[model samples]
Target: MNFPRSIRWKLQLWYGGLLLLLLAGFGFTAYQLESARQLRHIDEELQQRLPMLVDSQRPIPGDRDRRQFRLSTRDALLFDQTGNESFYYVVWLKHGEPVTRSTTAPEDVPQPKAGDPPNRLRGDVRESFLFPGPGDCVLVGRSIAPDLAGLRQFAWWLCAVGVTVFAAGLAGGGWLIIKALRPIQTISAAAQSIATGDLSQRIQTQDTESELGQLATVLNTTFARLEASFSRQSRFTADAAHELRTPLAVILLQSQNGLAADHLTEEQREAFLATQRAAQRMRRLIESLLTLARLDSGELSDNRAPCELNRVAEETVRLLQPLAAEHGASLTTELAPAHCVGNADELAQVVTNLVGNALVHNRSGVSVHVKVLIEDQHAVLTVRDTGQGIAPADISHLFERFYRVEKARTTAGGHTGLGLAITQAIVTAHGGMIVAESRVGEGTVMTVRLPLALRGADST
Candidate 1:
């Protein structure tokens, strides 16, 4: 059988298995000891009776026949007066043939063979011999049926007690394991909560000397350090983005003034145009970085309001239509009334980023299709592009910050590569999810799902 996955179950199994082995060992030892004790008791009884039986029988008066013997009056009185239910027999033998036997002796009772020891036969029925005179032997046989039955009853009781003990051990061991591992389970639950963006949660330690308590202490320290590190990084990005904004704006304005001046030569105009484009690209990169920093620092609120997703999709398509036309791509939309609870501005940004990526990352004459509908009480927005599809390996990391498909293919557009990452963060803040699917030659499809506003749904 395959082992269990939980530590509690594994501990219970091992403990139960060990207890079973112990019980089995103890039962076997008890059974052997009881059987031996009964046999030893029978042997003692047979030994005591042999001499008396031999003494009781004597040779008949002047009889030369070896088979002739008689019991004394005292021995006959003693044997007949005993009321014990255990059947016993005595026999006198000479030269391996019976000379006399007691009245109650069974004719078929086993006799000792030649060369056998005095106390040879031992079992439920035991036999012992006595040599009192020359060429004369006496054999005593006793039925140990009472003792045998007592031993058998003891064996059954031992088995019953062993089974009861084993069952109790399993239950008690399982409870103890659960109690011992409760701290570890708490730690695991805290770790899961922290992983789901609640870094404020910490493991509470009850006993520092215990292993789980020590682990909790270490994990609490690690989480504190991680939260501080993330805070510092977020602050640094926000500061840098804020610092670069003014300079980029000045650069753009100066380049625009130079381009509009009447005295500028052709070479000068081209240079100024290039400078303006570079400044604009830098500004867009800084803005994306600032948005991500705010998201990380929890400064941007997910303002919950009724948002019509179909309206957002239609606007985003219209806004990106010029870019698609410039690349010889067609923009089409299939919109249904889909309403969700989110910030309209952020949802618009999400649609803009998706549609913009589709249009910019496509070959000429490719079609970009946008769809908005309600599925399973969630607003579903899908953007599909008939462009060069993503590589299989790159699809998983597409939403990761600054990850690009192929360096050469991505270099043509001045993409900062933070679009999908920001889009995912915004969707997650709104309690939604986004997924991307692509094949080598087919195309790419990005699906976004947001929970529908309860009030809007009720009204509908």
Candidate 2:
């Protein structure tokens, strides 16, 4: 069985069900009690009139027949019945025939014995029996059809009243539940905004002492600290990378000059060459750092013109051809016009990092295929490599900064472990997403999806 996903609905069902159960029980109990009370009232009335039937007996003064004389005393008690609520009686002798009976008494009433029970009910009739003499007995009764009808009506009314009360209570309870969860909705929206790279977002707490209010306050404080820490880190990275550029350039320049000197011995020339290579590697590392730091600070391209995604892929392919040849890897492409809005340089950098990562991390003879096309109103680019696939456990961490899988392959070039990180940062800045899919012994596929440019964008 599937339960409701919303807490509000779950709580509503539980409380509403409980309320219905309670109302059902209460209504049933009330109906039973009222029915019993009405029956008791009928019984009491029959009991009281039973004595009247016995007392309304006498013998005629000069009449020879005692039964005929006994009938003469009941002039006030017997009457022509006009309604179902009329009282009547039937007196029987020991031989089982009625000795004396009222005019209003039912003809079908059995002749009750002297030792019969005091009260009984058959259908709508209530009766009480009594022994007036050694051989005479009396039964007094009334039609209780009116009382039964009233009780039926009362039962219907109870059902209606119960349903109305339950409906009103459920409505009130739903309103209360919505009011209680409004704070959680606000918290969710604020957290979503903050997650989408806006660290400045904070939850608004109206009451600091309440439970939810206290939670919001704590979250807001945490966001403030996070924003402060990221700001300090970005500033430091940008400042340090910028500061190192001048000295790194000097080192490169001096090493080149030393290599050009004719007076230097062979060993000295090799030393200078080694210094130049190290300086060049350091310069490259610093450049990568500066690029990452800028992307982290949300400093993207100044010139975000409309460009075809296929054009960027073609250009990146041309630039990386020499590296592909050096690794004995085959580079191929299937390009389609996929127009988007972004800096061509930044987009090219993304493609370059992905292709280079695939080429550098795999052994010789690995085939790399680049694809660009439009899919579902978005520009889709894929880089698939026919090499040993990534481990299942490592795919989740592929986009994290400096994360590299420990695969057995020959590295054809230097990897700073920040390539995929930079690519992810740039794609996110362009409102895009990237995903990696792979399995053991199967090849890996890197897919990037970016929103399509407007129809009027300059694809040319």
Candidate 3:
């Protein structure tokens, strides 16, 4: 059987089962002890009155009927004629023949059987003690109807109390299980937030002595260190990119001047041009790095405004048309009013990079389609290309910094491998998401969904 993987249910089952067993054992033991004690008490009473019953067997003095009696108009305590006691006895002769018996004695009690016990129950009678003497043997006993009824009621009471206690125990156990797992739930929630790029989340430390409390303390320390490490890395990248800008600009200027020299041979001109191209590529890489660092720091969060996604897609297509022509790729569009709130320039970059990627990385005659539409409350942008598709393993890492499906740092088109990563960061900043779908030899589709701007909402 496949049970749910829930610790709460498992603990409840074990705890409840154990408690039920304990209550059943206790109630059973108590009931058996009480029943035996009642029977023993009744037997003791019967034994104490057996000799009196023997003495009361003689006929009363001056009685005309000649029937045995202990006294004339005796107290009902002897045979229960005046009260509710049901005591009775039967006397027998030495030869096992019946002699006399009390008025309340049962007529069905036959002669002493071979296996008759000294103290026994006959029919409804609880206890009948045999008192054997020189001339007579008496059987003293009483009916146990009232005792049986009381015991039956007691059994029901025990059942009722046991059921109540068991139910209460199960409820209490379930509550305790939930309480015990509360810290784990808190930890999971905090960890999920951290996973979603919020490294500032920390588990609350309410009980340091517990095991889970200690674990929480360790996780908090680890998260703090992680936050600090990421902060340093971001600062370093931004600083390094900023510091390289002037040097790269100087190198580019020097190479451009050298290439424009009047006395330069053909080979020298090519060399200078190559140097200039290299410097330009380095500058673009540095710019991408700076952009990533800014995105990491959420610098463009305040630059958001309401914009039409259709306008952005149409303009981006127009801007990239020449490049698409150069690569022999077809560009298509189905524009709709897809209003969203984000930095228009960043969202445009997102479109430009996706379309440019399709154009640069695919074979000639591949078609690239740009779409802008709305689905519910989201502005949807899809850039689909009939180009060589990405591998499944590489698709997951497409947004990772400096990762490329081609696995090379430099491409003929000078891709710095940060374009898609930047696009993802920009989309995330806009409170949006992007997805890539592809199969080998079947082309790729890049889909972006941004929160739609509400009607009449103004740009910030």
Whole-model lDDT values for every prediction: 0.80, 0.85, 0.83
Candidate 1 lDDT score at position 453? 85
Residue 310 alpha-carbon offset, candidate 3, angstroms:
4.6
Off by over 4 Å in 1: 1-5, 63-85, 90-92, 101-108, 113-137, 142-160, 306-340, 365-388, 407-409, 432-437, 445-460
lDDT of 1 by residue, 199-292 (tens): 7789887798887888889999999999898889988999999999998989999998888899888999999999998898899899999999
Candidate 2 per-residue lDDT, tens place, 1-460, comes to: 1456888889889889999999999999999999999889888877777666666667666853454314334544443456878888788765668877777888899766556677888888888887766777788888899998999999999999999999998999899988998899889899998887778888987888999999999999998999999989988988998999999999999999888878899889989988998888778778888898888777876568889999999999999999899989999999998999998999999999999888888877889999999999999999999988888888999888767786644433556678898898898889898999987776789999999999987774
Candidates, ranked, lDDT: 2, 3, 1
Pick by lDDT: 2 or 3, better one: 2
Weakest 10 consecutive residues of candidate 2 by summed lDDT: 64-73
Q: How accurate is candidate 2 locally (lDDT)?
A: 0.85
The TM-score of predicted model 2 comes to 0.81
Task: For residues 60-105, write the lDDT of model 3, one tens digit per residue.
Answer: 5797434453523563456755333588767776566667667787
- Give lDDT: candidate 1, residue 364: 79
Reference-based TM-score of each model: 0.81, 0.81, 0.75
Name model 2 segments beyond 4 Å from true. Answer: 1-6, 40-51, 59-172, 205-210, 263-273, 301-303, 408-412
